[model samples]
Target: REIERDALRARLRSHTGSRAELAAQLGISERSLYRKLRSLDRPD
Candidate 1:
């Protein structure tokens, strides 16, 4: 799960778009996206 989340984050960051826009494209809420990113920032 962590690896996949990291990959998804990398793929999203690779493109040029607003976070809100990217979240929408990913079918998630902006808040949820932010939460996911925040969680990903933590060392496992």
Candidate 2:
């Protein structure tokens, strides 16, 4: 399943924890989170 970009952005904005922690909360790997963020930066 894919995560929504807006939801990801909202979580990132509100999150005060480290990337690893956020990844754990989202049930994804830290590397996956980074990839998602990177994809969000690119032109769809």
TM-score of every model versus the real structure: 0.75, 0.90
Candidate 2 regions exceeding 4 Å error are 1-3
How far is 14's C-alpha from truth in model 2 (Å)? 0.4
The residue pairs in collision within model 1 are: none
| Cα-lDDT of candidate 2 | 0.92
The numbered model that scores best in TM-score is 2
- lDDT by residue (1-44, candidate 1, tens digit) is 77768776786769698889888887889998888888888877
Give the Cα-based TM-score of candidate 2 against the true structure. Answer: 0.90
lDDT of 1 at 26: 79
